[model samples]
Target: MDTPQNTALTRALTELPGPLPARGVIHIVIPHTDRFTVVGNHLAQHAGLSTVAVGLAVRIQSLPQGTEIGIKALAARFPEGEKLIAAALRELEAHGYLRRAVTNLPNGRIVTRTVFCNQPTALLRPRVVAQRPAPPQTSPPAQDPAPEPPAPEAAAAPQAPALPDVQQEQEPEAPAPLEQEPEAPAPAPQDHAPFVARVPPPTAPRQPPPPLPQPRELTAELDRAATALLSDLRRHARQLVLSENDIRQLAPAVAAWLERDTHPDTIRHTLTNDLPQPLRHPAKLLKHRLTVLLPPPLPGADDLAAPARPRIAVTPFQTCDGCERAFRAPTPGHCRDCRNAHAHGPAQAAA
Candidate 1:
């Protein structure tokens, strides 16, 4: 029988004395009766995932179906910026905790479908069912036939005369065993060589794209213009900041564009407009754009001849001295009628 003092002493030893020590995390879990989400240890204690990714995954799981979990929405709700949120989402996707797929609807609308997996490992691994050995088949024991009823007692019959015992006279000797023939030795098995698979010859390596065309002659003015344009690209778009080496390497390509009558503004717009987010290789992108969007050289004047226009001469107006009459003449002089009258007057006077 246990005493009260012993029981009390045992309880005191097992129970904690005061507040818990500040060491690692200690849970005082209170079960939620309603509105509780179940999180697996795979996600909560994953070694590969960052804390942000783990928290983001949990938040996504707790939300109701069809809720917006886009980068912008998450960024608005949480303190993290869009870049960090996007990075966390990518991490989750890489580790199989989340999946996003684009689907096109019949009505021509595109939508993204998101799926969250609680146990990614379990989902990925294949399930196996163990097969048990079958029990040995047994047959039922056979029963003996029922004993026949005892037959009536039969009458005694006379015994026949006794014959001489074969054993007592002479036992016939057992026949001699037949002589056994010697067995022939078996032939040895032949060793089979392993099959050698013939490998096909390696295919030719893929060729890289051709280099961008450069200007025939890089003049000082053209070089300065191209360099200035490339250096100023960062003002329009921050992501397009190019280094000195990049500017130098790409100056010739830009000079080619300038030589072909392509404006600096047009080049800048082509490089900076509608850029993809998180541009990784700015130099390579600019190089490709410069090559593809290069303008054709201006046509020569001789090749594109303009049509000749006809010329019309305009006469000047003059006022006659004798009469105030306006007439078209080369110089300031009398009208045609006035001149004819003067000539006739002189002839009349002479006559």
Candidate 2:
């Protein structure tokens, strides 16, 4: 079972110049740890170094020295078969793990090589947690949980002390009243008020409310970054941060804090939500498109250059309200069903 090539490959991985069990192998294995899930999920797709497959590749060597090992040889001895092994290694390298150091083997052919890696190639994950079965499902009943004890029947409200219905006191029908004709009286008050000219009270004008504080304007570049990050995060659980906004609402105070106070690399300004579905994690759609609103103020830009006019963008609002479906602004308001329902309140109201 130990051909010279096989033996050399095994020896390279096992004797990798490292100090951990299965020495050189941990570079491949450690990344698969829970510590790197976010970056791991991102990389496996974009670059391929998902830790599970990569870690197993390294661990198979069981060496304890330097992690300097020939990748071709490691690939050969991997437990998960060479095809997946090469795939993982290629993925790892593409995602910026061990660089490709070409080493000339004794046969004078250039062989691909791998260097030991102790640092992560992608975003930071202080610790990667291994997946474990959810702690024995103590979650309350999915349906029909234990019935709540019946609330004690409210003590019958004390019967209003029965005041005998007063009206039942049959006042013997009042004896019939006599009828009589009356004489007309003369008018006299008009002249008294005439001298006091009819006075009308003065009306006071109402004050307008103070306007809401204006938010900082966002920039186009900020919008691009926000959208890119949103798409990047979607691969992971939405709970991890799925949907993102266009990035325009951040107030100046908040934008300064996000750019200056937060860690340079950590998520700065973000909002998230939980959604219902097979995609169990909540999807967080961004509220304000941020990218356009966060950059340094542009020189000589003015939003108010013309005479005031009421120009309401009723399209997106109308779609969200009337169609019950999300649509970009400027959707002709002409979806077939929408046309059929045009008689609905908003369409008719806007028209």
Candidate 3:
């Protein structure tokens, strides 16, 4: 009968045709000791260990000492994947199937060594040994020194300057000219009459400004109308509430309808007609109806109710981050539904 090491080597040899390669061949033996048997049996006892962990442990135990195992390598070999393989490694270590030790070198470098055990055991802490001083070197034997070179001489200084001669040559003087009469001042511009011979006719009197719109008019009552619309919407679906900002947003849509010469009542009727049983956002629904469902004007009526032309430079309202459902808010934040959900979360939790 072959020993465990020989048995493993023979099994490995079976994979090759006839002869084993001289290099790159690793010999690993599955120990047949009682400790190894106990460890194999104990693997099944770890309820927390997943199938991936068990597979990793078995693979690690089958490898020769100092064999490299990397995440990408393991991922390529096993179907469990790198993430699961990494998680499994942690689980294996936590359950004592693996022990890792980090050693620090005298050069301030750190090296990590992991030991996989067929049987689980406590980890061995790293021990750092003090570095010893190197031996002193002997002095070299005395020898004759080389001769020194001579220094160069300094340059001589210059002599003092002599005194200058008096009376230098001068240029000839120019002759004076006779005086002449003084020049006269220029005359001022003559006074001129206005461009027009006669004054223009008196202008027509300015007309008084048109009277301000009354409460009945949609323009003046836009805010109140928006509020009223919200109240009516709540009656159909009770979850809707428009903030002041929300109400202000609806004014432009209502104003568009008014500009189309659409009666306030007709606009409201068209909006509330055929409403859904459950409405998530009343403001969004109102905006869509006002902008899209708005009726064309009657014969000989103005088309001012048409949507404002879209411009690339002019950005529309921001979409809600929570649902991306509505553009009623000015900034990218959670919508009312998300806000309500957050507000009622505590109450729901208590129940």
Candidate 4:
């Protein structure tokens, strides 16, 4: 449960005066609207202010400690036109959503950071739900055993002649037979070495594993598409230096793109998995892409085995331990405050 002070604080944050724009209409974030339409200094202020408010409140509500609020994330969430946001920013500055501001340039747009002074109400705790045990069930009482089944009526017994008991007894008494000898046990087989086991001699010549099965090749359309992909790859490979995987994506796609008989998903898998080298070589750019992004080999294909890439430099950014804040790197490989905080982790800083 939140303390009374915290609850009061959560309630105090106000909603914007009027109803917000209707859901599903063109807002800046949706791709449909021309992103650059908002013009003039006044409209720009509205665009900036409205968009900033949306960015600031939501960002504070979702803020991660020690991380900066990036402009791209804010722009992505903006509902109003950006130029209108610029105009609204002045109003917000007069009101109080943003305080001391800083900004950066991205994709040619100047983006500002709105440093938060207080936590937003949206971050407040939600009501808790309690779990309860289920009720027990009862069954009906036991009953007496069922009655026994009826028996069949017996037939009259047949009469037999009395006779030969004396003769039968005399015949049995004539002799007692001797018992037969028991059979001998069979010999045990010798054991082989622990590691030795009979294995078949090599049957087929060594080769790469067969490619993963493709979509039904029985269809005429699949054959046509396969041919096209092979041709495209040949063109692509001869002209460009594909790494091999890219060629695979193109090959199956040709079949998929041309074959009305195949589903897009199946075509995609075929193109990506068992595409022929003839088509693959021409699309060297794709091979380069796949080589970089996917280092592992495709099923039943060559190991790809590209060489190790050059190392990249990562410059450290400044961090404020007191408030758990990190600003973008203004310089390379050093964060002054985090280093100076006197709370250095046991591990020594890199030389």
| RMSD (Å) per prediction | 23.9, 47.5, 43.7, 43.7
The 0-to-1 C-alpha lDDT of every candidate, in the order given, reads 0.85, 0.47, 0.65, 0.46
Candidate 2 lDDT score relative to the true structure: 0.47
Q: Please give the clash total of every predicted structure, in order.
A: 0, 37, 0, 32
Predicted structure 3, TM vs. truth: 0.23
Candidate 4 error regions (>4 Å)? 1-93, 97-214, 218-250, 261-351
Better of 3 and 4 by TM-score: 3
* TM-score per candidate, chains pooled: 0.32, 0.19, 0.23, 0.17
lDDT string for model 4 (1-351, tens) is 555566543443333344334344422232445423322343234444555554444444455564543444444555556555555444445645445455657767765556553322222435334334344454877898997765443334454566866544444465667866655545433332234435878899798533323343436756555544454443423434444454455454344344334444443343355444334233543433333332222334244566579998776666654555776675433346665654466445542
lDDT of 3 at 267: 63
Best by TM-score: 1
Whole-model lDDT for model 4 versus the true structure? 0.46
Model 3 C-alpha lDDT versus the unseen true structure: 0.65
Error of 4 at 46 (Å): 10
The candidate maximizing lDDT is 1
At residue 228, what lDDT does model 2 achieve?
A: 51
Poorest 10 consecutive residues by lDDT, candidate 3: 209-218
